[model samples]
Target: MDAHHPWNMIPLPDHTDLNLAEIDVFTIDGIFSTPRLDNESELGYSDHHENDLSTPVPSPVPTDTSTTKETWAETTMAPPPLNRRPKARTLRNEDWAPVKDRVLELRKDKRKRLREVKEMILTEFGFEATERQYKWKIDQWNAGKNVRRNEMKAIVRKGQIRTVAEPDKRSLTFELRGEVVPKEKIDRFMKREQVPFDAIYSPSSGAETPADGILDCWTPATRFSVGRTPTPSLSGEALATNEHSFFVHNISSSPALSSITTLATSRPFEGRSPRLLHSPLAVPSSLEPNDVRLRRQLSNLEQSFGEGSEPTLGTLLELCNFLLVHGRYSSAETTARKQLAACRSLYGDGHERTGMTLSMLGQVLMLQGHYEDALGVYQKAGVILKQTSGPKSEPYLRNRIEEGVLFRCLTRDEEALEILRRAEATAQQVFGRTHDVATYAQLRLILPLVELGQFLEVEERAKELKLFYSTVTPTSQSRRIIWDVNHSLGCVLLRTGRLKEAEEIFKSIWRDAVEISGPEHPASLSYLHNIAETLMLCGRFEEAFGKTDTCISSRISVLGLNHPDTQASMRLKDRILARQRMVSRVSHGDIVQSGDVM
Candidate 1:
């Protein structure tokens, strides 16, 4: 079955026409009112009047019997009188402009009757209008205004624009939250908007060529062992100088980009990892602390790196990784951009290296909640990789996964589901269903389906994953996959209001994850949170509160107080407490009423 076609489109309720009551007066007493009967004298008077009216009434004029009979037949067979009133002119967009203000005023006041409004419209504007047309116009005006208002508010909140103006006079001078927007970023924006690039900068200044010296060293490489660093195969035969090798070798020594398997194998569906395609680690606290040793190492690298040197790219990548893993996404984004610029300078836009750096920058943008920008970057990276590394390559698949994630974040659930479904098929065909790439795609596919309220499909996919893992060796990775599947299924159950089943699943998953990975692990915390929610829904308020407190404390310790998970736990606790108070008040009121009745 096509996953894309599985989504159920929930139709909105049919709209009923507005029915206005004709009578102004209504009373319950009218139904119970007694009926009065006429007395005997009044009945006798009515009989006397009936007797006096026995005389026959006569016609005013005589008529021919045959002609009258013919006329009667003609009258009986004649077609109904034609509706002689001319049809009203069809309404147009420009025609509506004249009455727009009147429609808006009447709608805002909402006190005038539709009949009165219609009459007023005909009298004042010389146009016959119906109540339905008036209502539709009002709705259209409000919807357009609301859309613009929401869009402006979003732009303002993101600090993308300083102020919102009228639609006729929208301002284009962007006021970025920080320093100037990069040239690449602006170029991308311009291209999307279909603005002429020549209007901003000349082709000479906008386009940069890849260094010819860099591409001469391209060579096929073998996969390395799991524990060993994966080195680029820049063979001695292909290299013109030792400097390139030194730069490449130095880059490999820095913190290995926690491989894709680190994401697929270990990180559960929690924290930023759930949103990311290949997050290095689940939480920031686990990243290496920035101490004197790290500072000295960076200082030494900076001292050795010269302007326009290839080694600078390695340094930039290091800085970007450190910043990103440590939750400094804004700084990481800047550094990633710098690294991308350097990569482009060396390897050009279409090179695999440039595509990788671009994908990294997109992830950083995602971390910072710039989903629109991140989506654009992900698309660019995907295109570059598909052109240079083939569509079946791992990088391209990863790009699709990240794009799906971004689409999900942006609340474009159907789009996310479609992209993920396509990617999953590709992964299954290219890498096999059991491979980590396919598994990752399968996992990501569940998220958007859940958002779309397609719980059955979610459950089916989840069950398939569980069944697949059941046959495999119970490695830590396999266990994690099973754990994630159960967690997601439990979430679907919770959302579908199967409180008891969901609670049981959450308890079992939480217990097992805690035993395996400890309470501080993101997976355990997530399951614990799920338990709290299920408990609350089941009316086990006290237990829910206690569990939530524990989850929040653990999240604070493991992730940080400002982490979204910790804040969400705190909010859930507040809601649970509020519900408890409300239930208590209602119970007390019921008891008081019972006592009074007794």
Candidate 2:
């Protein structure tokens, strides 16, 4: 990582023997410079062998600050001197000569294929477009010279060589418009070029394409493969492995890099395409937007693994999309388990990414209702978490809250309450009682109380929560927690014979929260259902029938007919019928209100 090492400006290979057709390419800042290829190694070149890409990548130097970069192959072909411009003298840094020399030493391969290998590497790194069938496009790629870039490089701007962004290098446009490469066609090509394990020259893989047959490919991540145009996962990295040869150059690595996740290609079915872990719907409450900046930071982490980054953005993107779709699940019991295992292996068990992936996967498990599975994932999370903040960390408390929730669901009330009480106390001490953190902990604790059937505790917590909600401006998640708490309190009131009070709270909340959170929300419906039961409990037959009717309609629309909510509605209707019969015996003619369901 020397500051003055020879840098790779173009993403193409430094060897000279690779075939242009088999490799793919794109512009490096739209300025092309011819690259010098290293001399051939004495060793015989092997085709189709899996390059132990696990070979250690040399630590990269600061990319933006360096000079004396390797020019692309296009730079070697000079056009007729414009107006016989004065002969230019090239500038190469004295300090960087050693780094360049070292790279040359490392790339000791057979000279016979040096040009072809270098060309293939460049193609893999996105130094040119996918070589076309037409002859004209190939000519333009070979001529990487431009009058404008040469002029730009002359002006020393803040001690850094200025590179212009390539407006014409709009790769995704051709891709997105469907006017360019197709997946099936590419897959066919990849299949044809797929070399045997013994023949692979670089750490790259080979896809057998019908047209080319056993083509060399340096895929970014395990699940996603792009011919050229640096994928997001591997976008930031300048250095790449083309089979056995390791070429260190410069490219943008991820800004939020906690550590890199390795391609877990070590499955029993190693030759097959690697599969990603599946995700569930209903993301965990933990990753909610409590901190927008942190959310964006993590999003950048996702983006860093996205289309333009190194590795393949597709693999990471798929993971995020899956997590977003599947509510938090029991990672241990599902695909998340594989995800955690793979991430830890790549980044090492103690890395920060290990924590992020673990938390997310654990949350996924939690949402899946596999309480034991969730508890296990959280415990695993705790192991890595302890390294950073010890056992008494905010993160640890958050994980504990999840464990407590699962415990409550499992009917281990005493244990659940104990864990949450300690968590609540810790969170309040660390983040303060008035903070959203404390409120979040409180809400999690309250949910357990509801499952434990502790009405008295629910009432006390509800009063504390109502005051908390009233005083603080809530976030979307905080509001949800408040609404859920309100619904729980209303249910406790109904169950404990405080029907009138419960009715008032439920109706008021429905009127206010319906549009804000939507009418069919699970919390909204629970409160509404409680109101119907409360009316029935009060023996207001006419009013009770009206509430029951609304409950039935809402349940049918919001939750399908056979759902538990719908069944509850049916039970309420039966209760209404019984109350009507009892009231009929007392009064021959009772004046029923128009709005009354009866």
Q: Model-by-model lDDT, in order?
A: 0.57, 0.45
For each candidate in turn, the TM-score is 0.44, 0.40
Which candidate leads in lDDT? 1
Model 2 Cα shift for residue 410 (angstroms)? 3.2
The superposed Cα distance between candidate 1 and the true structure at residue 455, in angstroms, equals 2.5
- Local lDDT at 579 for model 1: 89
Model 2 weakest lDDT span, ten residues long: 265-274
User: What is the model-wide C-alpha lDDT for candidate 1?
Assistant: 0.57
lDDT of 1 by residue, 1-598 (tens): 6455423332322224323342132222122211111221322222223434333222111122233544544533322233365565677755664454334333322245767767755653455666667666654543111223232233222222222223343333321111122336544554654645333322323233212222111111311224222222321111211111111222321132222211111111122211112222223533623321233344455456632246666656776675554443434544565466567557655578878887887786675544555676777677778877898888899888889988887889999999999999998899898888888899989989888989999999998888888887888767877888888888898898988899888899989987765666666888999899888888899899899998997776545465556877999999999989999999999999999999
Q: Say what the RMSD of model 1 is.
A: 31.6
lDDT of 2: 0.45
RMSD (Cα, Å) of model 2: 26.1
Candidate 1 colliding pairs: none
